[model samples]
Target: MHDVVIVGAGPAGLTAAMYCARGGKKTLVLGNTYSSQQSMGGLYENYPGFPDGIQGIELSERMLAQAQKFGAENQTEQVEKIVPLSNFFRLKTENWQYEARTVILAMGAGHRPLGVPGEKELTARGVSYCVHCDGALFRNKAVVVAGYGNGAARAVLYLANIAGKVHLLCTREKLVAESVYLERIKNLSNYTATFGAEITEIQGDDFVTAVGYKVGNTPRTVKADGVFVEMGMKPNADLAIALGLEMTPGGYVKVNRLNQETSMPGVYAAGDLTGGRLQVATAVGSGASAGISALQYLG
Candidate 1:
C-alpha cells in the first residue's frame, strides 16, 4: 500500500507528488501527463519565473522530473475506476490495481472538438483548441472561432488581439457570453459574429486556409489561417462521480477553496477537475494545496 496515490500526472498531479514524496510519503502518480491540455498548449507566457516563456510540454516534463527526483513513482496507465475501501482507496487501471491511504484526483479536462471534416487532420497544422496556446503562431493571420459561450467569446477576444481577422460562428440565435466580453467584441473592428450558423467543414491542405459553415440556408466560407474550436471542455471526473463526491453544477469536483480537499475525507482534488481558471499556474497552486492537505491528513 502506498501513502498517497495521485490519479494524474499533469501540472497539478506532479506538483502534488513532489510535495508528498518530499514529505517522505510513498507516492505514486498514475496517467500520462503529456496527454494533458497543459502539454498540448504549446507554449505558456503566464507561468511565473519564465519571463521569456516556456513550452507547455517542457514545463510538464520539468514538473514530472522534479517529482521523480523527490522519489515519486509514476505510471502511464489510464485509471479505469477508483474504489473506496474501509480505510484506504483502491485504484484500478488497465493492468494493475493500487491501494493508498490517501488519494488525489488531478485528472484534467479534455477539450470539446468540432468533429468536422479536416479538423482532425490539421490539428497541429492549423486547427487548435487553445487560443492562448496557438494564437501567437497565427499573429496577423485570419482565424475562425467555432462555437458559442463564454469560452468561445474569450477565444474570439484573444484571437482578435493577435489574428488579422476574427470570425465568431455560433449555431444559436445569439452569442452567449459575459456582458463585458460582448461589449468588448462590439468595439473591435476586426471581429465579426454570426449566430445560427453550423460549421460543415474545415478546409486546408498543409495548413488551415478556410472554414465552411451554413447560416440558415446560405452556405458560406471564410478564409482563415487558423481554426480555434472553443466548444468547452469535458472534465475527467468519472472516478470522482463514482466515488459520490460533491461536484459543482458545472460538473467539476467540488473542493474546499482553502485546501483542495474534496467532500470526502482523505480525498483531494486539484487542477481542471476542481475547475476554475484552468490554467497551468492555477493547477500548480491547487496541487500544492492538495499535497499539503494530504500530508496533514496523514499526520
Candidate 2:
C-alpha cells in the first residue's frame, strides 16, 4: 500500500508528489496520457519564480523529475474507479489496483469542444482549443475565435500577436469579461469583435478552409487557417464524483480552503478539478495544500 496516491500528472499532482515523497510517503501518480497539460505544448510565461518563462511539456518534465528525485513513483493509466477501504483507499485501473492511505484528486480541466459539425474529425487539422500552442503556427493568417469569456479574450489577445486578422465570435449579446482583457482586445487593431454570433459549422475538405457563422440576421464566412475554440473548459472530475465526494454546483470538488480536505476523510482534492481560478500558479499552491493535508492524514 502506498501512503499517497495522486490521480493526475498536471502541475498540482506533480507538486503534491514532490511534497509527499519528501515527507517520506510513498507517492504514486496515475493519469491520462494525452489530455494532461503537456499536450498543450508546455509554454507557460505567467507562472511565478520563472521570469523568462518555460515550455509546458518542459515544466511538466521538471515537476516529474523533481518528484522522482524525491522517490515518487509515476504511472500512466486511466483510473476506472476509487473505492474506500476500511482505513485506506483502493484505486482501480484497467490493468492494476493499488491501495493508499490518502488520495489527492487533481485531474485538471478537460477540453470543452465547440460541439459544432466537423469539430471532432477536423480537430488537429484546423480546430484547436489552445491558442498559446497553435497561435504561432497560424502567423500572418486569418482565424476565428468562438467565445466571449475571459479564456476567449485571452486567446484573441494572444492570437492577435501572430495572426494577421482575428474575428471574435461571441455567443452572448456583447463582450462581457474582465475589463482589462476586454480593453486590451478592443485596442488591438487586428482584432474585430462580433457579438451575438455563433459558429454553425467548420468547413474544410481535408484541412480547415473557412468558418461560417451567423451575425444577427446575416450569415457570413471568414477565411481562416484555423478556428481557435476558446469556449471555456470543463473540469475532469468524474473520478471524484464517482467516488461520492462533495462537489460544487459546477461539478468542482469541494474542499476545506486551508487544508484542501474533501468532505470525506483521507480524501483531498486540488487544482482545476477543485474549480476556483484555473491558473498554473494557483494549482501549484493548491497542490501544496493537498500534499500537506495528505501527509498529515497519513501520519
Model number with the top TM-score: 2
* Residue 31, model 2: Cα distance from true site in angstroms: 2.3
Tens-place lDDT digits, model 2, residues 1-299: 99999999998999999999999999999984245754474456677878988877777888889999999999998789999979999999999999998899989987688798888878989899888667888999999888878778778888898999998889899876778777877689998877888788889989899888887779988888899987777989888889989989998899998999999999999998898888888999999999998988877
Lowest lDDT block of 10, candidate 1: 37-46
Instruction: List candidate 2 stretches off by more than 4 Å.
Output: 32-35, 38-43, 132-140, 157-164, 172-190
Which candidate has the highest lDDT of all? 1
TM-score of 1: 0.75
**Clashing residue pairs found in predicted model 2:** 42-55, 42-56, 42-57, 43-56
> How many Å off is the CA of 171 in candidate 1?
7.4
